[model samples]
Target: MTMEDKREPKRRNPAKTQARILDAAFELFSSQGYARTGMREVAERADVATSLVVRYFGTKAALFEQALVRAIYERGFFVRSKPNFGERMAALVVGDEEARIPAMMVLAIADLESREIAQKITRDVVLKSLADWLGPPDAQNRALHMLTLMNGFTIQTRHLRTGDVPPESVRWLARSLQAIVDEENAPVN
Candidate 1:
């Protein structure tokens, strides 16, 4: 080939590469924490050379971000899939449609985890979307708080521990959050 032709590197399909890398990272990271997942593992899973992962994601940190983002969106956190916050939250509480939140939690607490990145994305992409479609700031906080409560609650529920939060408390929390939203949206004198 001519020097000009040699200089022109073959342009691989970006979307396909992104999906393959994400799929590989998701499998590895979901099973093993970020630190434990190596580029080789993802490459093997993706049926691509390890260098391709580096080319696509730059670093494992970046790869993890793509993996997590895809997992969240791919979990079916969309309105067409489920139209209500209760349904959405409930899915998360038990397990999302993808059953990856528990794995995500473990991954998030890993040394390489980036809660700042996670929260920002969660808020900007996940929470903000839900808020705009659902309600206001209070609704936003409510969703966040509920997520925390569910996290703890699910752990206890799994162990069948005593002093568990009653169903009524969950109901109260939901109603109170709604009240806060209503109060904020109320007309000022």
Candidate 2:
């Protein structure tokens, strides 16, 4: 065999490493929250070094944004179901009433902060991407209606989860809103 036979294949996959960091970041971030979790903690949890986490993700905010993005990605809800925004928004309350903390964290992020983050959450998930699906709002009020309904459902369901699945509570809100949208979407008499 030639000396070139001695060469070993690459041991670490960049994709796998990046995924590990992201997974660890999400675990720590979701449990402890962005403000509480540190790069060191994520690196330790991922079994990588602290510098590696920082090198890959930069500051805490950058790492956190990535983690939040991961949470959204792992959900992969939009891709699988591909429902209308209002339907998808209603769906959250319909399924999985067991745990809501992480989503509550997402809501808390919007509630606690005042910056581009809030707008990004609103624009990226609650509005533009999904709105683009709906083919443009008829008016400003209509836009607000869709956005607020989605962005607050988790927070709204906080009380409902304490007892039963709260179908009546969730359906009341979902159907009431759906009624108006459905009515507006209906053919004129």
Candidate 3:
């Protein structure tokens, strides 16, 4: 095959290439922390040129922001998928290391502090969606409480990486969250 023909396979598909770059940035930022990671490292890991990474994302901060947005988006934090979702989410917090919620929390806390865009996404996309799923009249308050607990659980499992959290504790946490779900669905007096 001609060299030009061989090189043709590597041509960028805009969506796919962008996804790959985001995936690479997510992994690197999660593992290394955002400040420590660089655009070149993300490019190398994504197997794309640094220029391409910059071309798509402009700045390292923008890349990191997009990565964060993608992670939150993937969790479907606002969508009510099923009954007992709190239990399911709690189970996920315990079991799904690859979910990266814990790592994302660290990134927000450590690097993205004072970034209005990040705050806006968290407040608008995540918090609002979660509150909406819980439904009114106390939905926002309930969501805030649940998020606090959920984040705490994620930190314990993902960041602390402590030996298996006691199964009973997991069960209790799930049950607590389940109670909230039950309340949300309960008939009004």
Top candidate when judged by lDDT against the true structure: 3
**Model 3 C-alpha lDDT per residue in residues 16-80, reported as the tens digit of each score:** 99999999988887766777888999999999899999999999878887887897777665575
Q: Could you tell me how far off, in angstroms, the CA of residue 114 lies in candidate 1 after the best superposition?
A: 3.7
Q: Give the CA lDDT, 0 to 100, for residue 14 in model 3.
A: 94
- Alpha-carbon lDDT, every model: 0.64, 0.59, 0.76
lDDT of 2 by residue, 1-189 (tens): 877898887697778888899888777765555567778889999999999888888887677666666666566544533334344557664555322323535543743442345456556654554444434235345656655655466555553346655666666666655653554465655
Please provide, for model 1 over 60-117, each residue's C-alpha lDDT reduced to its tens digit, 9 standing for 90 to 100: 8788887887777776554542224444454455443344554554455656355555
TM-scores for all predictions: 0.65, 0.66, 0.84
Runs in model 1 deviating more than 4 A are 1-12, 78-97, 112-116, 153-189
Ranking by TM-score: 3, 2, 1
